[model samples]
Target: MAVIATPVDATLQVVVQTGTDDGGRPVTRVRSFRNLKPSAVDDDVMAVAKAFANLQAHPVDSIVKVVEIALTEEQ
Candidate 1:
C-alpha cells in the first residue's frame, strides 16, 4: 500500500485577557488549537478568538492574545 502524505499542522495558543493582576497588568488564560494551518492570518485568528471568548464568563471586551506553537509528538 502507498503511504499517504499529510500536511503538518501547528498549534495555536489563544491567551484571553480577563482582568488585571495585582500589578495592574493583564491576566491571561491559554486556549489551544489542536490543528492550525500555518497560513492563518492574525486578523482571522483574532476574530475567531473574540467570538470564542464571548462564551466565557468574562466580558467580550477583554483583550486577546494569539500565539502559535509547534506540536510535539512523543516517541
Candidate 2:
C-alpha cells in the first residue's frame, strides 16, 4: 500500500509587533491571508507579504506560510 498527499488549501500569515505587553514583552498579532494558491512560489509569497506588511501600522516580525494537505491511501 502507498500513501499520497494532496494540497487542499493554503494561507499566508504576517506576524507584526503591535506593541509591548505590560511586562515589556513584545506583543504580536497574526494577519492571515487565506485562499492562497498552494503552488505559489516562496519568493512571490514573500514579496506579497512584504507588500502587505508595508500597509500595516506596526513592523513585521515574521512571515509564515500555512498549507493544508489531505492524505489518502493509494488504491
Candidate 3:
C-alpha cells in the first residue's frame, strides 16, 4: 500500500518578544495568520512575515509556517 500526503491549508506564525517575565526571562507571543495558500513558497512567506513584523510593536523572534496535510492510502 502507498500513502500520499496532500497539503490542505497553511498558516503563518510570527513569534515576537513582547517583554520580560518577573524572573527576567524573555516573554514571547504568537501571531497567527490563517487561510494562507498552501502552495506559497518559503521565500514569499518569509517576506510577508518580515513585512508584517515591521508593523508589530514587538521584535520578531522567529517566523514559522504551519501546514495542514491530509493523508490517504492509494487503492
Candidate 4:
C-alpha cells in the first residue's frame, strides 16, 4: 500500500485495486463515501462494503474505485 500525506484540511482520495474471485473475472465497480472519520478513511469500511455490494449485485469478479474522504483541520 502507498501512503500520501496532505494538508490537514484537504480531501483525501484513495485508489484501490480489487482482487479477482475464484472465477478469475475482473470487477469494475466504483463507489465513494464522504464526511468520514480519519480512522474510517484509513480503514475504508463503508466504501469497501459499498463496492463489494455493487460487485455482488452486478456479478463482477473484482472492482476498482477511487474513494474520497474529507478531513477536518482539527484532529
> What does the lDDT read for residue 72 in candidate 1?
52
lDDT of 1 by residue, 27-63 (tens): 7776676666756786886777777777777544444
Tens-place lDDT digits, model 3, residues 1-75:
999999999999999999999999999999999999999999999999999999999999999999999999999
Predicted candidate 2, C-alpha RMSD: 0.7
C-alpha lDDT (0 to 100) for residue 44 of candidate 4:
66
* Residue range 1-75, candidate 2, lDDT tens digits: 899999999999999999998999999999999999999999999999999999999999999999999999999
Task: Candidate 2: list runs displaced more than 4 Å.
Answer: none
lDDT per residue (tens digit) for residues 1-75 in model 4: 444544333223333446567788664544443444444454565466555566443443333333344444533
- Segments of candidate 4 deviating more than 4 angstroms: 1-27, 41-56, 60-75
Residue pairs whose backbone atoms clash in candidate 1: none
List TM-score per model, in order. Answer: 0.45, 0.95, 0.96, 0.27
The positional error of residue 2 in candidate 4, measured at the CA in angstroms, is 20
Candidate 3 lDDT score relative to the true structure: 0.98
Model 3 alpha-carbon drift over 4 Å, by segment:
none
Return whichever of 1 and 2 wins on TM-score: 2
Best by lDDT: 3
- Report the C-alpha displacement of residue 46, candidate 1, in angstroms: 0.8
